[model samples]
Target chain A: MPIPSPTVITAATLDLRGRPVFVRSTGTTDGPALILLHGLPTSSWLWRRCLPDLAEALPGWRIIAPDLPGYGRSAPRPGAGPRHLGGWLHALLTTLGVDRFALVGHDLGGLVALTDAVARTGRLGGTPHPARTGGPQLERLLLLNTTIYPAPLLVLGLLPSIVPPFADLSLVWLGRGGAARDDDRRKGYVVGMRQLLAPGTVVEAVEWAEYARPYGPIAGWREARRSLRALAWQAPFVLRCLAHLGDLTLPTRLIWSRHDPFFPLAVAERLRRAIPGAEPMIHIIEGAAHFPQEDQPAEVARLIAEFLREPR
Target chain B: MPTHTPVRYVLTSHVEEHGGRPAAATHAEIFEQVALADSFGFDALWLAEHHFGAQAGMVSQPLLVALAAATRTRRINVGTSLIVLPLHHPLMLAEQLSTLNLLTEGRLSIGFGSGSAPFEFAGFDAPFDGERRHPRFREALEVIERAWTGEPFSHEGTNFQIGEVRLVPRPTRPLREFAWLGAMSEQTAAMAGEFGYGLQLPRGQSADHYAAPIGAFRAALRDTWGPDAPERLAIARCVYVGTDDETAIAEAGPSIRRFYEHSKGYDKTKPTPAAPELIERLHFIVGGPEKCAREIAAFVAATGISHLSIQPIWEGLEHGQAIASLRRFGAEVMPRAEALIGAERAAGVAGQD
Candidate 1:
């Protein structure tokens, strides 16, 4: 008859320009906001394992996990692009009455977080310094397994894939799971998952369904297509964000996976070196691939919470 | 002897399979108990790892349990009571511990055992004989320590051959891994002391059995590290306090006996003294709160080991039963135990004068 009490996580939605943003939150309402963002093909649920611990670690902080548009429960708009994604997220947070908050983002979510920071700093093509250029005061930031700045060749390859015919084919081939020769429809998603998840780790069927659900339909694929196109065109803007990365004048820690397929340890090391700050500790998560957040949530949460709690 | 050191309490849990009870249920209870221990301000919490036994222990992976406890509690140090190190690849173990250390904010402590169960070792396809175990544990410990250094190193021992390997996501502090060894004899204790590991001693042994190893370790520690250094040793005891001594015996004796016998069938490490006289002599704290406090205080004074780990969960001990005793120990026993130890210290100081 003995069982641990369930953690109290409230699922709610916010209206941003007529589109609803799905969010799961915990801790006190008036506490300092801590926004958690998830990467592509995964939604706010990816942060599920870390949320409870995060809530435990920072009792006075509000942990907000929102499903970006077209990801989980959020409705994707027709014209929403990568540029609009950050704006939409900022608007959603503002609507929630969160003005200043710490941002923790993973993978593509990390890229989105950078864009959001850069846009706020108003340094599209301006001289930037961490101390001088900033809109809202960023209390802290944690970037995981993401590189806002990419090698030109990497971007060049992705650039062609985002073009019309290629983008359409790429959407089918890369979205949900991936393109398959028809053994199992779920196999495409499984293959993608295998690449993302550490070997010897098992994901329950239900959990896989939650991640693959978004890419199951034609509408989902269309939304992914638009998100991709946005990413491809916003290359220059992303580079700008990368340029003014020092505009983030707060304590930041980059937690990266050593074996990440897309952005390996070298990418995180380069980013860590380039990031101008007195308080940046680059930690490499061992034995994890692209999604260390999901692979080792406790370790990921531990590093971030410790950095946040530690005096700078 | 000076009773100046304030005895610190730690909670140890071994979720034994109770009469057809599910393993999952036992695991759930343990997590809750650990969280409560953390909130109650216990100094630390340690876990029991078992494998391939018929309902002896439900938790086979203490590292996984430590990870779970880290998420649940904020301040409590999480450690394994004894991880049978011989069964695992040293590099893999090192990687796991290093990553866990980073996660726990350097609050991770490791305890290694030369595994005693042949079947359990066989399950992992590892060499399980006594002849091989000592060598394996020593070699494995060497590799684990080297891996924590975060430096590219190689080992060319008799058992292992590797070339220029460095662990990634290394421990934050290079060349350091906080560790404990639940060693059984003076030789092992000396090794543990020489290597700067905290020595962990379990209960159910003869009262005299401990002092020898501790003394040997102290001497070895002094020889290796210098006389000014402090020795850290943690002792585990079986404890249950009832309203009165008679009630305590009636309530806890049978369960304690069952626990020892069940243990005897497995874990061929140390022989436990279960005779009534020996049990009393070994000082299992089964009595009223006042008597229990005095016993614990006396034991602390004699041993000079400040850290006390109490096994609240055992074979035939229900979850609620353990909780009741735990509450009484914290609320009633700890304060009195401290007061008694203080009085002893005062008496010693006055006698010296």
Candidate 2:
């Protein structure tokens, strides 16, 4: 039996903090909000498979997935650091008039969410920042395949420091198109994205094209390199915010990919122990590499729904 | 009389190396053998896991090797003959097995055992005490079964203090069907039956050694799951087929002796038997097609096993010779053995009438 394709995602651009931030959304706007944040090297397209299902599962809740400041169709913001990305999320939520919401973050987006949560709860070991004053009330937090400790980020972070241009250059080279056409460039980016999935996963051509579209041009690479450079530069501050993870008071849950080479189960284990209010076990998604959303979309959506529907 | 059951042939390997062969080459040969088994219509390929012993078996992670085999073959099922359960965290093992099952499209089977090597347990920093081992194994298996349910569960056991956790990518099928317990003792056999898992009888033991355990296993299954419950029993045997009995012994005799010599070095306390008595005790089935078939039929009828896992390759055996034995067994011995079992079953039914 053939499985039906996921529901089509609706995309639009919203002006947040003087920059054009692209958002992919579904469900009613007036309902309680559920914001999804994508990580590095990806945009709102990361949530394409899970968005509609999430919307269907929640029924009345608004599901909003936005590209990080410098990814996909969103215009890159100059001088934005890792912590600044968290501030950018607050600004995006305020601009969207989302006062109370649940947040789900993956990869680097998870770092951004943790930073924001820490800052909001005034746990950053300093005077509370202005972004914490009137931000959206975070009801539930979900983190997927992300790291709080600095050890896991050392490879990606230190590579740039050790060999200044080696990381981005290789990515750009591997992401180079065979031909001058835009479709060829998209296919080239698809090749790069293929490395992030579990072996033997059969992805559709159209879906691959959608995921690779944002990185199809030289401008996309420029934004991606900018994001990477910012992350590499702000590693210390990110670690500082992560250190305050024990201070987070929100109801948190971790859904991790078991085979994720970048952020292994050990990282999730640490994070689960760090968070005081975290659910006892780190829900492990098997048969997936870095991206569980792509490898097990229905399961991801179902887990999200199950978590969100739990009585507070 | 034993119940009539159709037989399944599985190619089992310890991935043993000899002749100063490199470990990489041994693995390459095993994969080639896996492809051969797949093409030759064998039911499954099972690999053994051994830690810190490259001579006995180089494969420390049999599930990874099974995953490699699963990817290479189209139809053959891949499995671990026994994964040392107590050495690994159950949640992690469950996740890995679940991943392998999904990647293979439900063609993954697993055999669990509380390992026999005290040194290996010490190496893993696990409790090697006999009293703690059984309880730890039971706790780990229980945790794994609950984790496969795709629902939030918690366990506060003697060995594990797990909080609310759920497994993802859920299970593709009922995991019990793919589970096997490697049992040598009557207690362990009863545990296997209680857990509703297939029972795998260990190799290198005589038929008399297995009789009590087999009886206990059947009784446990009948008492726990009812009389009509399905029984999946498997036994391993060292087999080699040549032109005839004399030639077979001449070719395999020295290699088999060397294999036992290497095994004896692992434990010096047990008295070592001479070559021929050791061969008889281990039940090495070496001969031409007709003789091998007759013995295999007799062994199957005696043990009432539905699956026959054959170890045709051993240390010091040439790869080509092992392949030839495999080809001959699949082509000649298997059919003849089936015919013999069928005749015996028919005669049993005739006697009953």
Candidate 3:
């Protein structure tokens, strides 16, 4: 059934850990909350494809998505790396009075969510705790194309770049990449997404343009580059996130893309067992790759709706 | 995975004799500057190589001055900005550098340039016309390197004719001295790359003007040298960091304007057209700590050059004030700028697919 367009979506910049973090929210005023987070080379735009379906299928379920500090229109706070953003995420949720919510994370966002969960759980004595006391309550956890094992490519690519002499070369490296003109950068991002998604995926030009805004003429690209380099340079935070990989004990689900190159089906299966007490039910979206949310949005949306209705 | 070479914080001394300080006091002050810089972890310290400029405390005998400096400072690298290659015989200069290297434990570097002042060329009985200076400078560099090898070699190039003669005392690290060419034009910059020589860009040019030379060097590196030939890519800047922006400008403004106005002996060119537009683009990274960090980060982001050699003293700015600026940059500005750059780089990689 085609989802109705009665859903309301609005955007705002909220004070998040002292940086102006841009947020996109949906659903009625008083409703169960769900916070969606995106991964690399994308912003809140990643959630646009699935929001209509989610809002129509589950009315009154508040959906909140933020363009992680430095990702989208958010004013990047100081040092928004992997170790840092999760704390900012917690601060954002606390500021919104979002004490309890279902958390869904993809790629780096997934790692950040898991970090947030472990941190909150660690603070609340590992049990169902009152929200007013402290920290957000994670009712259910969901992972998609998320980083679990420190994949050699991800870990190794950033390793030497953070070391002393090489660490100093980060600006040179970023400058080279950022030198691409705005149009060329836009085209590059689209070409990159094609390699990451299912082959022959027809991404509309308008959609691509929306994603390309950050890599623009001057100010936008500089802002994006500054924010991005800050996160990539945080090696210590990457280590901390990797250390807490096995602590997600919430009622969890892992819906993965069948052809995902970054995290294969086998990796997803391993994650089912790796989330300590998760015993996650894994669903595979067939016509997708690293980004099932984009390549097969309908299937992803259906899987999410079904998962939300499951008996706890 | 990638790693970087060490980014150097070199100190440049124009040796402007502030307020009639005795020449001995000025020389002592230069040595004291080197000692202070060595303690603060500066990569290399250099005094300008100007001659016949009585007002400027130019170190005409650079190797001798460096030899003297090496005695007081344990670690700071000592060198001269430009030692007019045509003024001295290449073999004798090579021999002196070899001896200085031995004395300094291989801590000496030399920046060789074709003398620009026609009068200085006339004083040395060398040609004052265009093209004559550079060919002599270039040929001298070639002969110097060939002679330093300590192997019997004969060179029969124009302006130089030497028999198969090997020196008795060779340099400790022959052919290892950091030899750079001061590139003021595209040809020079590209030549620096093609000949595998380090580049010392003329001081005070804005970042926007650096692209052509950097690009030219890179192209030469790829096509001719097969390496980014510069042993170090050094650019000079005038910097002043204070507790705040207004104060920094207020403190550094007059001397800087004086530098543009009267410091003609520092560079061979007509005193920099420090016109209103040019003055607006002064190489002074003048501001408070955070503001300086932001400006410097932007500069690095624009130009990927590695070594930044800064002149903190001169044109009536006192020695004590120069020390404060250096300390502020070394202890406060650089660290904060590094943190900002690191975070920006980290965020950039994370944002990439």
Candidate 4:
């Protein structure tokens, strides 16, 4: 059954221990809320294709997409990075009045959501608190193409800022997938992703005409850029937190694109070995590159539904 | 002087984020603010362009065009208060502005300014020599204007060296009749006169200070370009209007004073009474409609300002206060000033007859 037109509700940025954070909900309010966290350089618009199906099949599900502080629509917190992100997500979910529900995260969101599960466990006094024994007993931990050891990226920073500025540049070029590289198209990605820190396909949906509405000028984009760059430097702490994921007893599933240029299949295999009591099913999306959600939304959605239906 | 028809008040945006205003001030808020200004009868809105700041003030070309996208649904004329001419090659600026003009249905004003901010000039690696910047600005302006003429042209000047280039998506008008030279010095004012362009007074300067520049332009036009030169002059000032003196003084005085005081060469942090002088000057039109009318009249008497661009909003000023102030300027203050202009124009006609 086709779901009715989606309803979008924008929530004001809440003070999470003095951090500015916001949440946006699409679909029904009474449904089980799936807190969808996006990756670097994109917003909830990354999930545009999968949302309709999730909304249709899981009529009891409410899709909660929050731009993490320093990404998308959310304002940045004074201190935000991979290590502190899980706790922040926990606080954000609680503030939004969401209780126990399955958490589905992708890319950066997956790491954040799993970390948040541990933090939430501690908050709810669940067994094996990350600070105490570490990790949590989440209902289900869903992950997309994400890295296990965030260390290698940090060591690359040993190079001077000028030399390795092209490090991320190479990644971006790969992400472009050889689209017609005109000034508009090139600047669209740079200004949208690097400057605004909130660029996504939603720009295509809205038409680029008034896209400037969400972003006033380069100044706003630059501010977002500065904060994102600072966040990129916090990779050491992110690697330190890897030990905590091992303590997670939750049934976890990892979905990855076989040909992901950023996180190879080898990294996903390492993640499977690291996690405790991991689920048997791992979906390796073929042909799709970094974002299988965009390239293979239907197949990914089907796999997710199948995974969720398996008996505990 | 006020005109026969009521003067329409303009609120310039410049997409600028100041001390109190952060870069993250939302677009939803910006759009709503413009709409509020329009409903209250603001005649025009302007956005500025800038590349880098501790806070990125503005970040793109077609700055006016982007702002117009947010506001084209409304009635007010949308434009760049002044796009820095030195930073962009003329051909690029010409193409962007022309497309913007065509898109906005002639609801555009082409404002060209010599790059002012030292930081902006340095960021672009453009020459920061103030004496040389004006010539470059003028050269770029010549190229831009020629491209807008809808006729193929070529020009080589001190800074700009564009060869036979015709602008695409040309505007309906062969030339933008509303071209403005954003003049900060007497030399620039004279250049505007020599080039047959309208004069745009700098934002922070008082009307009294403008007297010399305006005079120099008129004198130069008469001496070299001949007295037959068409008069096209405009002035921009920071202004705030209220229902009464107490209300205006209480609401807008601090913010407006802080703005000018923060401006280079006029630091309020020093022990100076710049605010008091500004309030008393012909430049700032504050208070009730009648009082504002009087101030404008005094300004016209002091300097023959035909077009006035008044900034009625600052970062911390409440939206309601700005709306009330703009409404008063449009409905009451404008008519009184227009009547004054009508009287002056009539007197001139009588003298001719």
Best model number under TM-score: 2
Which segments of model 3 are wrong by more than 4 Å?
A1-312, B1-6, B54-57, B174-177, B224-231, B263-279, B347-353
Q: Model 4 segments beyond 4 Å from truth?
A: A1-312, B1-8, B15-43, B54-75, B151-158, B204-206, B219-230, B266-278, B281-283, B340-353
By the lDDT metric, which is better: model 1 or model 3?
1
lDDT of 4 at A160: 19
* Per-model DockQ: 0.01, 0.01, 0.01, 0.00
C-alpha displacement of A212 in model 2, angstroms?
69
Two-chain DockQ for model 4 = 0.00
Between candidates 2 and 3, which one is better according to TM-score? Answer: 2
Inter-residue clash pairs, candidate 2: none
* Location of the lowest summed lDDT over 10 successive residues in candidate 2 chain A: A160-169
B1-353, model 1: which lDDT tens digit per residue?
A: 22476777888876778888887888888888887778778877788778975348887888998888888888888878888888789999888988887888877767887877778887888887767788878878877765664645567777878787878885665221357888778888887775657788887764467898898777766554345445678888988877877777777877776665665454446665554543475457787889899888888878778588898877887788788878888888889999998998888889989
Cα lDDT tens digits for candidate 2, A97-157:
8888998989888888777777777767666655567757788899998876665566666
lDDT of 4 at B195: 54
- Predicted candidate 2 versus true structure: per-residue lDDT over B31-90, tens digit per residue: 888888888677788888899984578889999889999999999989978899999999
Q: Name the weakest run of 10 consecutive residues (lDDT summed) in model 3 chain B.
A: B222-231
Model 3: per-residue Cα lDDT over B1-353, one tens digit each: 12134356778886777787777777887787788778777878776777787436556787777888889899988887777788889988888887777788878767777877777777779886766777777778777865664544566778889886765476545352366777777877876765456678777778878888877776655443333233467788778888887777777777776776665545555555533333456667777888888877777656766777877787678878877877788888888877766666666678884
RMSD (Cα, Å) of model 3: 24.4
Error of 1 at A211 (Å): 71
Return the lDDT, model 4, position B141. Answer: 69
